[model samples]
Target: MHSQDKLIMIYGANGYTGRLIVDHALEKGLKPIVAGRNKEQVKQIAEEKGLPARVFDLDSVEQVANNLNDIAVVIHCAGPFSATAKPMMEACIKSKTHYTDITGEIVVFELGQSYDAQAKEAGVVICPGVGFDVIPTDCLASQLKDKLPDATHLKLGFDSGSSMSPGTAKTSVEGLAQGGKIRENGKIIQVPLAFKTKTIDFGNGEKNAMTIPWGDVSTAYYSTGIPNIEVYIPISPKGAKKIKRLNAFKWLLGTKLVQNFLKKQAGKSRGPNEQQREKLKTYVWGEVRNDKGAWVTGHFETANGYELTYLGAVAVAEHLLANEIEGGAFTPSKLVDNKLVERLPGTGEIHFKPE
Candidate 1:
């Protein structure tokens, strides 16, 4: 068998985020095999980067597993992960290859967690949200839990200045169809769109954030043992109101015609250019409260979401290559550490306040 440590495979290497990860991997002096359903595009990127190439799709676990035999880690970047994560994850588990993805979808995180035992048994790690989706926020949650060990509830929010990638926009379209969610007493509870709003001071100033079904709703609970968890993203009052109004038409949004149209529109986006990625910033905040009402709040600022995704994803994959961590489904912070966010290329020091 070829040395797995030297063989990293990036599935979906032609997509917006995937290409960034590929470029970053090369910059770090690593030659990763680029693979995707689009044979021509994947091969083109591989040839341009002077790396190996493979072509495969998530049609079946057996098919994907066949392609993953010599791969040590597979960064599954293709999405909507709701449809893509399962087959790719199962393939990794079947092939006993480590699996990672930059997915922010709650179902995908939950799906990774569900395979924990199998992953451990297979001696293969399966971790999702290795990107901007939950790394910073998940790490923040872990830090807050460490600060307030008896915390009963956790709240997380993020403020980003970056625009959405096509994958992200398409994922947002899918999330809107599912409404909202939060973790309550260790159970996932579905709520209305923009179900709750709060003003959070994410370091710089006060920003209005609205509850969204972020991946941390699942990963944080597992990471912190917090019985209740809620994640929010910055939104204006007017935007929140508009989202609330969207509740009545959510069913319509789920229809085939509307979903297809929205997805097509989302596909048109090329995401941020190099300059925008360098200039934009993302801030993440977290608060933990115990029964006594004592709370600890903290926030950290980092690179733009897409830039951070590629950086975080590559960092985790490199960590997997260099170290021997336990094999199981994990949040990024769990697989790495809470300090992983701080170690990113463009992250500010974490700030915390006790109240």
Candidate 2:
């Protein structure tokens, strides 16, 4: 369906990424209804953008469900999704409305998956991690599996400019507070924050990446039937060293005080500003190996990951509006066609090498 006739609601529409999604949605000719707990903020945004706005408090499930009626889909952009996802998913399923979000929280993802049967029963699709946090890696893993039928081990890496938004920084802090995980020996294993580090070359240059708990650990396993998967994000050597040292005090991760302290520190240490966000580029690299002593490596470069996230969210909205998606909880890799990667707005240069 074209965006013009669809009634799409953007929850948390006042946040940095949420505002970008709203702007992109409007540019695509969609009139998005911005919603969040902050009615004043959302109202101000709507008034400025000439869009509609609503107030949605997660504490009130009935109100959320009431608001979901007649909406084509709800794009839940407010995160640390661990707290928001379950209630939102329940509301969508009850209202028989499609739902999508940019959440990369593994705990949130697992909780969403638990509602798959309910969503299917209600004929409502629940798709999560429809953003750079996992979509590229998830889609790439699916593509690699299609190429190598027997591929069993998956390693995905990416390096991008440091110009991250406030929401991204908050998400990173949340991830640091909650340690990451990786699939090893065909089983899921908890990993200390910044447990593993390696250098990844993105054709243009090389950068060091540390293991981060990416949502793909949940998505790729079911999508590609791969038991072992890991995702890494390249960081500066100095940052890597600092992370390594911090990881030694693993007990600190369990305390909310420590998490808040780190969050404050991250906010204080500015990386890139708005101009840098416009100029920054992102490069992704993936390697798939099997037990047969064969391996395949692929590289892709695109605009900044945040921009990709906005486009991906819009793509998801389009799919839901058109009824192109099946009713169930799914990751982007499982719900969308690999070919749609071409339709997605961005220049993705992909190359594969054999080893």
Candidate 3:
């Protein structure tokens, strides 16, 4: 139990993933304060759960910190975090509150790391990418990190047969303009989409995978000290061709008119329904190697990514509130033990293997 009677505040509580986390909290009988920038939407969800609600923008760091008064840990579910994370974190640091968010954007990881010393000094934890974006991959990196302790390079990948949430889709649209990125020798390097391709057997079978600028590009470097990192995702041949074309026209995608049109089209749909989400499965794979050519591979199969976020984020929150974890700007892997995903509540839904 949390000793201080401090609340777990769910910022952006009305978001697709945010609402799920709220439900999970309620189901566990852990009372969390619901909050967001939308008054009506946040109030409705808060009313439904009988939880306290706060409505405010990131415009005022003072107010954000004031609102976090009784909160011990915050679950920030809003995105594209590239825009939202900075302000929220700035406020959290000032408020001296532990912060965690379901962010996959590499920019957010970089932002968090930049505040590492401040977070430690403030006696607060700043952990982002607690979602599917990297938790599972972060854990797999640890597995491979242990397997090849002197590894200098890391390759991590995941495939989940799940629908994209509106927030996830929005983030993708934002990234379309940026192309792709990878971390090399402790630096982030931009590349065109599909810069590299490989075949990965994510337990079920081998499939075509494309290098992507997943969160691990930042998190893995910090978590395992692997200086070179690349993350991949399985895509169809058609998907590959589509991405190549998008890369060619990325500049146009960056234009306000095109981005607005895409956003409007994207806003039409929400995330998956419960039936759809529960049926989805996720897979993660990682390989780490040294200059000696020695390498190790690891795999993990888990429940739906969104569901895991609810579980993973809440568990991390409990750990934070209990001071079972340390204060720092941390990736999920670094803040928690080696097998956090396996130790989580829904562990029955996960399978892990090493080779």
Candidate 4:
């Protein structure tokens, strides 16, 4: 399943992160067919990259499916995945094409899992969270699970001092009303933002961490079968307090007008440039504790989170195309060995130690 042999369609190929994926895919000499809802942007980008392009919307899912006729894989990159994941995945199933996306949305992962049987029946691989949100953490969960096979509880945290892209910011803004979430006893549990805070030691020292609705609440569970899961991202103490306070205005945040206003305020698609990504470093920590009260704590070091996301998404896609992946929904860690992520291109200085 080398690039030449597989024609991969990149939906939302003109957006910030999508363009990164497309540029990197081209650099790797992959045969990509770029598609998106925005015809002007999509065509301009396709022309610049000298790739074939198509424009379609999820509203006409059958039309979307038709355009995917010969494409073996589709990387759905347009998101606020809350609105995009289900429709794009349904189109993939309709087209019998393998589905992948650079999404870290909790609802997206859960939706992907709900479509597992259908995906398998359609002979398609439905995988989401092929990005910073869960790739490293999912692998960490797998690593910890291996060290503590009897592990029943999993806690994961990551700190990467990097800028967020406009697309990412919009996605977060889209979920302002829903608040934070976690997995307890395999059930999705909702909680207020920053409901839990702690000091997490991710290799160097302790940093202020707070609970977030990270995709691992779903992905890691599927990957490692950990019934209890909590994921945290670094936050300032003040920021943590602010998150909790924001919940009082959940109704205001949930309003469409507010979400749209924030989207408009976000301006346009943007991301950290190469030099910025090069300077950024990422750290991840995970702990798996069993009922016996024993636990294995581990840490992972990698390049920037977003950089790793670009590299990991493509690497996972290539691995899936070149090899045999089970037909159904899965996380990166579940589909490939934990070592696969550690071995990704540009992935440097990874150490997983049980303490």
Candidate 1: regions farther than 4 A off: 1-5
lDDT, candidate 4, residue 295? 87
Model 3, which residues run further than 4 Å from truth?
1-4, 324-326, 345-355
Instruction: Give the candidate order by descending lDDT.
Output: 1, 3, 4, 2
> What is the TM-score (0 to 1) of candidate 1?
0.98
Estimate the TM-score for candidate 2: 0.92
Candidate 2 collision pairs: none
> What are the TM-scores, per candidate, against the unseen true structure?
0.98, 0.92, 0.95, 0.95
Among all candidates shown, the one with the greatest lDDT: 1
User: Candidate 2 on 195-256: residue-level lDDT in tens?
Assistant: 78888886567777888888877778867888888988888888878887767677777588
Clashing pairs in 1: none
Worst 10 residues of 3 by lDDT: 346-355
Off by over 4 Å in 4: 1-5, 349-355
Q: Which ten residues in a row have the lowest lDDT in candidate 1?
A: 1-10
Candidate 4 differs from the real structure by a C-alpha RMSD in angstroms, to one decimal, of 1.9
Work out how many backbone clashes candidate 3 has: 0
Higher lDDT: candidate 2 or 3?
A: 3
Q: Write the per-residue lDDT of candidate 3 for residues 237-351, one digit (tens) a residue.
A: 7888788887879889999999988877777767778888778777778888899988888776777888889988888887787675556798888898668877754434333
lDDT of 3: 0.85
| Each candidate structure's count of clashing pairs | 0, 0, 0, 0
The C-alpha lDDT values of all candidates are 0.91, 0.80, 0.85, 0.84
* Candidate 2 wrong stretches, greater than 4 Å: 1-5, 236-238, 265-274
Tens digits of per-residue lDDT for model 1, 263-327: 99999977989999999888888999999999999998899999899999999999988887668
Model 4 earns a TM-score of 0.95
